[model samples]
Target: MRWMKVMMALACLGVVSACSVVTGGPLVRPGEPTGVLEIANGSSHTLTVILIADCSGMSYGLNRLPSGSTIPPGRSYRFTTSAGCWDVSAGLAYGTTIYETRFTTQVRPGRLTRHTVTGR
Candidate 1:
């Protein structure tokens, strides 16, 4: 009788544990959704953007660094970064000259930031 009671208790515990595990919703980091960076080229000539990003918070490591001279005019390039902060370095290519600039941004999840470059 004691062995039967222990087996019944163990089975009940297992079922309860399984239910909790199975019914738990997806795990999302605090302030989830990540961040997006968009570079819009409004300059009349074809432009290229070389983007480098350094990120921190929530997820760690791995940032996209884009290179090569061909972003095209009136086009936008969008990339996602971590949901906290990013130090972005951009190199703009116009004609045969290259100009470099660096800036930092605090990013919130699901928000889009558009940085437009136009004129001389």
Candidate 2:
């Protein structure tokens, strides 16, 4: 009976550990340096929406750009975040145009990671 109880406790511990994966644990642990993510607009269209997701997330959290703002062609925007890999998407003003060139780039500590979106 004791052995069976031990096994059950171990099984519960395993399940709890597995829950971290589904819970979206921290991408950058405490005390880690952050970096800059530069989204450069090489495409002719103005960018009205920019969303970024940490690799651990199920979906993009929110639009990083400020409300009523836009990034015109040849311009760029930067975000300061924990140094790690991220997925990025940028779209046009009407939300009808999403650049197919999705970004899965690595950001180094205290460095700049640039992902440029060009024409189709």
Candidate 3:
């Protein structure tokens, strides 16, 4: 029956869909400016931004910035995204101990989260 097929499709979608429940009612809410997270790399080596969201089961995990994508030295990447988890942690992997930073507060709507990686 068509209804049966529709139900199955929705079930599959639900199994793959991931949502985040943030406190303070989400920064952006229903109608508001979306938040952005920007990262600047001043180190000599390329860097990658890895995000661990509260719950991410979608394709390629819940990474806002996928892996393999490199941010060359002296480059910056701005992620204009929204929150889908109650808590999110962002880390800058510079392929060395020279510099590293992790920000646990992330994906907040209506706000711009910024992180700069520099040599220690």
Candidate 4:
């Protein structure tokens, strides 16, 4: 009788545990409608750094280009990001000279946003 009762209790406990809601996977959700950003180096300098910040003024946290990578003059680089408003900053390689500083642009999903950097 005691063994039967223990088994019943175990079964009841299992049923109770199964009744509780259980969820798994990513704890945080991602932004919707990702888009692309195309930066064209229309200047005489090699494009080195690309910084992106959201409309809320929060930066995307780092340079969009990989280390040691650069877009030569007349070339362009594309970046995939969430669709929304952004602030773009582009500078010359190995110097403090910036051709485009905090240039605001809109990125739409399923669309390409093209921005050209001049030698200003």
What does the lDDT read for residue 55 in candidate 4? 56
Candidate number with greatest TM-score: 2
- lDDT of prediction 4: 0.72
Model 1 local distance difference test score: 0.58
The predictions' CA RMSDs to the true structure, in order, are: 12.4, 5.7, 6.5, 12.4
Segments of candidate 3 deviating more than 4 angstroms: 1-10, 18-33, 52-63, 66-68, 83-101, 106-109, 118-120
- lDDT of candidate 3 over 36-101, digit per residue (tens): 766777667766544433343222234555556867778877765555442333344544643445
What lDDT would candidate 2 get against the real structure? Answer: 0.77
| Model 1 agreement with the true structure over 17-46: per-residue lDDT tens digits | 564344321123355677777767766655
Q: List the residue pairs that clash in candidate 3.
A: 20-84, 20-85, 35-110
- The total number of steric clashes, by the backbone 3 Å criterion, in model 1 comes to 0
Model 2, residue pairs in steric clash? none
Quick one: RMSD of model 1?
A: 12.4
Per-candidate clashes, comma-separated: 0, 0, 3, 0
What TM value does model 3 have? 0.50
Name every residue pair that clashes in candidate 1.
none
Question: What's the lDDT for residue 116 in model 1?
Answer: 70
lDDT of each: 0.58, 0.77, 0.54, 0.72
User: Residue-wise lDDT of candidate 4 within 42-104, one digit each (tens)?
Assistant: 878898888776656434345668888999999999988778887787877537645554588
